[model samples]
Target: MSDIQSYKQTPKYETFSYLPEMNADQVRRQIAYCIAQGWNPAVEHSEKENAFGHYWYMWKLPLFGEQSVDAVLAEIEACHREYPNQMVRFVAYDNYAQSQGMAFVVYRGR
Candidate 1:
């Protein structure tokens, strides 16, 4: 039988959770996708231990209509710089659906 008790698994967040950590280029691609879909992008961060919690600190207001990919990337970079010790996440808010459309960790902090 497998020793379930001895096996330790890392926590997985939203999109790309099963894949390797995404690079800046990959992140940019995701942001571009969000913008292409006409969804708003938002930045958020949380302490590593609290990453699974229901709430995280929003980096700023969500970027409304027709945001540039570079602008979204800049906000992500700023949040990472300010919260180097915390986990940073990028998300897309769907205005039509009036809810979060997608989310994934952009940076992981130890």
Candidate 2:
């Protein structure tokens, strides 16, 4: 039997925001581009409202060993350039030790 308690899984990368103008096709295309660039999509969530009349899409990606923030940022920037209609933002989380292993959060706005 597998020891569930002995398995320690790392947290997945995540990004969130309220993007009302982004349509399903646009979001999916951007995600596809990111995946083509070697980024794996972990999860996505969205909601629609008559009041705001906008749709939101949250996405997550998996991170491997140590990665350079600049490299990640550059990749995101390239994505933005490739898709001018999409507004993308990135944030890095500091690990508990604050020594290394930072996390990245990417937000794509319409």
* Candidate that would win on TM-score: 1
Q: For candidate 1, lDDT tens digit of each residue in 11-97? A: 777668667677888888888898989999999999999998889999988888846988888898999999899999998999899
Q: TM-score for each prediction?
A: 0.88, 0.29
RMSD of each: 4.3, 16.2
Model 1, runs deviating above 4 Å: 1-8
- Model 2: weakest 10-residue lDDT segment is 43-52
Scored by lDDT, the top model is 1
Q: Write down the lDDT of every candidate, Cα atoms only.
A: 0.85, 0.37
lDDT of 2 by residue, 31-75 (tens): 545544444333222221221223323334533332344444455
Per-structure clash totals for the candidates: 0, 0
Judged by whole-model lDDT over C-alpha atoms, candidate 1 comes out at 0.85
